[model samples]
Target: MSPAGASLGATVLCVLAWAGLAAGDRVYIHPFHLLVYSKSSCERLEKPTAEPAPHPSLTPAPIQARAPPVDEEALWGQLVPAAQKLEDGDQARVAAVGMLLNFLGARLHKTRAEMRGRPGAAVLSPTAVFGTLASFYLGALDPTASRLQAFLGVPGEGQSCTSRLDGHKVLAALQTAQGLLVARGRAGGRARLLLSTVLGLFTVPGLRLKQPFVQGLARFAPVTLPRALDLATDPDLAAEKINRFMEAATGWDLGSPVMGLDPDSTLLFDAYIHFQAQMKGFSLLAGLRDFWVDNATSVPVPMLSSTGTFQHWSDTHSNLSVTRVPLSDNAWLLLIQPHRASDLPQAEALAFQYDLPMWTKNLSPRAIRLTVPQLALRDSYDVQDLLAQAKLPTLLGAGANLGGISDRELRVGQVLNSILFELKADEEEPPTESARQPAGPETLDVTLNSPFLFAIYEQDSTAVHFMGRVTNPLRGV
Candidate 1:
């Protein structure tokens, strides 16, 4: 134990500790490493592709102007029963589907956020988007089918037709994902959420689609209606007809009608989803509250407030705060806000560009007095437009093989997915003077008075059903 020996050992320990920290910092992996295409895949995608196999023809079910009402009880009964019968490798398939959904959802959200000079609130459903994509996969052939299988992160890339993943099975998994969200909301005999999704196929008159393709739509959505319309001859009128039909079918005035109908488009596919949730113990505060749209601009919007111990995380390095609120027993909402009001876009970019689900993993329980805007957001985007924005316009273009959907020359003009998300605090009588006690000093006050981002995810599967950026609560984009 000489002084020289002690000093040498201390110096060595310090160096080792510093080295450990440096190594830890350098051991970082990008979230999208596995999802993005490799150099070879990109090169292969650019090469000339083979033609599609001849599609079989079947008499489609009679076109109906109005789809029958969905029996919620029966629908859930069927979905849950099948979900319980989890086949071997089903977990992997479900996880793959969820990962793809999150990846696509992030890309679509970032695209929408940057589309305008000033980003507006945009809402999208990963479920509906995935369903729309799955529908296309159902009808795709050859290279297109294999390409889609890769894009969707599903197995079955063999050259033989038998190797293609079954669309029915994929769609059924999607329905089961939806089922988990809704079933968990209703787990405690409380109707916290009401979710309805429909698929509308508007085609040119006399266009014959495969019976299996039409029937397979039902496995994903409760209602699938095919109607003959002149989408090419009268784009405006066709848009009006679709708007009215969806309104009548879903009983929710989506606020805006369908737009941007392709003039030459023979088929227009629409997936409309309506989601409403009532937080169990939240209360609607009286009068309108000032929601800062920017540093200077403010708009009055209805606000909801609740106090509870919720999972919360604040990333000082990223200058953001995340709050998790229970939507149901197994589904929760993640609210991400920039610490600085003006940094919303940057915060959003950071959240989506890298790993978002990773943020959820860091959250721990904290007493919070949370106030958020009453969200009534409706957003619709053409999947084709999204594809184009993502630099793959020809993925579903005219040359693509969608022979499985129709027998004749088929061109998918538009695949639009519309989403409506409404969140409200349950109605309650005004609090009495004595009952309205102030929150304790230890309670963290988190108010979403500025632009922010959000997502709703399933617990077990980690499926992100919805993702959005709320720049303006009043806009409801």
Candidate 2:
């Protein structure tokens, strides 16, 4: 996959601040986290001719305070209030997470662009990838540590504890935002959301890992476990064991057997995420719809459709249309489809730009009839290869000082991220699902009939949680 540009080629160390810093019981988080503050693109979409222009954003009326039911320990959620309002800490975390999200979005885009029209869907998690890097940050030294701290959206650094942002706080904030989305329906007098992140460290037998690294990982994943592997004796067996262990740990097979463990290495790092959301007011079309894989190719797919007041924006200059389709109470699946099927790569590249937040501008509320293919993506990626594709090969490539991970000489091996993303109404019919939203021909129809890009973002933090593209809807996830 091709990279963004030469700027993206900057060494990971340049982003690191190793000045007079040492490994400690601290993690720094940059405070200014928001990536897009204003619109700076083709044009500020004006009013639509066919109907009254939709509101710039679907900002609901003021929400009153109330005693909301939510899992405080694991999730930050409340009733009555909408997600637009952000707290100081949450805002900072949003910016830090946003940067990582942009990077990951670019990675997803490159992968799909490299293999266009592949018979599978692609997905990635912003927080999960960031968490893995956080583990690295936990073991970093001085200038590098400081650079990571700032990159992660932690601002101000000094000898004083007051100046540094807590790494645990940043990780917790991301987890909370994720939980808030998946668990939103349950808190709002509906059903529970199914989402979780897991981090694992598989090391060669008898290897000792740093306590701070182990403990810091807890902030990112609910279940942070470190296990043993024998890559030297039998690399293939070791790979099989690791794969089975992950499957058992996450309750889902990785599909592909874990391969290519560096026998000389003593440690392997992995992160797993499972994010699934059932649309509240959606129903699958009675029969499969014809989705065009290309101008000459079409396939049948089970499409989900809904009708509601949604935020809509269109860019004629770029020849793209976007709509904020509600996935969960605290999250919106921002769907971007090109006016022309061949324009997908261009639209995807544009989406990767740092100013993507501007793309949501000038959108107003409109009654929309939305239909999209169900996305069930379960995939794993080698972090090393991913970094290379992102044009920062050496970020985790050669000369990576992962000294913090172990007390003895160790070769890093198989840094894989297992991501699972699924969306649907529900398996069993509730009979009332269809009636949840008014459906008719009067609404503006926004159907994803061809290749498109989509991202799920937390409304409050404005942080993109998941992103990917689908070319053939009929392809199994």
Candidate 3:
């Protein structure tokens, strides 16, 4: 698979893979707190009993293209993804999730730099993008589908001999990760992280989308809408409707990008993700700290400080310091800051050198004091540009078989992945002043007062679910 394809597949798998890691029991490597997905680590859940069907491929959906969105509401369908009753213990699962995490970390850094990784935050969901490609894969045929499979990694018993992947099974793993989050109901003991994902399909009026493609979409979003849109006459209006649907579904006033759909449009696709995790256990510092965007520029913002037995380490080689702190049972935050005040840009450049898992694996722990800005990332970007950066610009442009989206010679419309990641401390109740103090005699003092990169990752899968840099905490919401 091309690097772009592999990166895209890893992104798709991340949807569920990142979320599922929250429930499993895993050991934290001291200093770095990197969680290795071992058999012993997954004792909380049983091994998957049986593999899903092999080569559960979708049929050619050459339905039609030049239709219009007649019944928008009725067009939406309910998605009932098969409940994951069995947990597959195959090593392939680990390898698949691990591959996705590494890809995600690389993409995160790349995107961050592209967006100017300072004075603002950049966020994107890998699995959400991956989900779109999977949908396209279903709509594609022979060579197209096969090529997509290479990027999406493997499906079913990935280790077993199989010419193709079961798209449903691969998507199911992501749902498995999402399942871990909701398993804890809100009443007795449940998390407050509001993580939601939704997918939308817009077709020209009166097109018969394949049941197989629709069924495949159900694996990712419970409600997959097949709407009638007049791309030829009113493409912008159609885009508006799609945006409104996304905002309504997510209960956030997040309108989507105004896409330049072809006037002779057949199909368009969009994915929405809304995630916010308010810090519950940590105490907020009483005053705002100065965040340096550069040696000359600074911004004042609230900060969070803590001292505890976190796995902390400094790499003199990279001139970077990293500390891991638990955000939730399912989420761990890796706080990274440069060792020298002048090495911020150099540290950003070094991100390309370390596959996060490998770089983190080498970290050893010690008691430390860490202070971070009260940060949140509301980041969005065009995947097309990102694809171009990956050196496969026209892969989704012309002659692409996005048939699973619609039966006709579908044109790839605006494919956008938007992410909303916000962090808040002392949500339910105020933390005591003592809770804000360091819990141990600190060995290292790492203060993120300048341009620094950080990620909230699922330890088990090592998936960097949320990644961004805070150069000015006062910038992005």
Q: Show model 2 residue runs off by greater than 4 Å.
A: 1-120, 142-166, 187-192, 426-441, 474-477
RMSD of each: 11.4, 14.9, 9.5
Ranking of candidates on lDDT, top first = 1, 2, 3
Tell me the tens digit of each residue's lDDT in model 3 across 232-329: 88777766766665565555546465466667656666666666655555557776678888788788887776665677777888899888776666
Stretches off by above 4 angstroms in model 1 are 1-64, 69-88, 154-163, 187-190, 353-355, 427-438
Could you say which candidate leads in TM-score? 1
Q: How accurate is candidate 3 locally (lDDT)?
A: 0.57
30-77 per-residue lDDT for model 2 (tens digits): 433232222322133332367743222111111121212223224223
- Candidate 1, residues 293-352, lDDT tens digits: the string is 889999999888888899999999989999999987888889999999877777877776
After the best TM-score superposition of candidate 1, give how far the Cα of residue 284 lies from its true spot, in angstroms: 1.1
* Cand. 3 TM to true fold: 0.73
lDDT for 209 in candidate 3 is 69
lDDT of each: 0.72, 0.61, 0.57
Residue-pair clashes per candidate? 0, 20, 28
Candidate number with greatest lDDT: 1
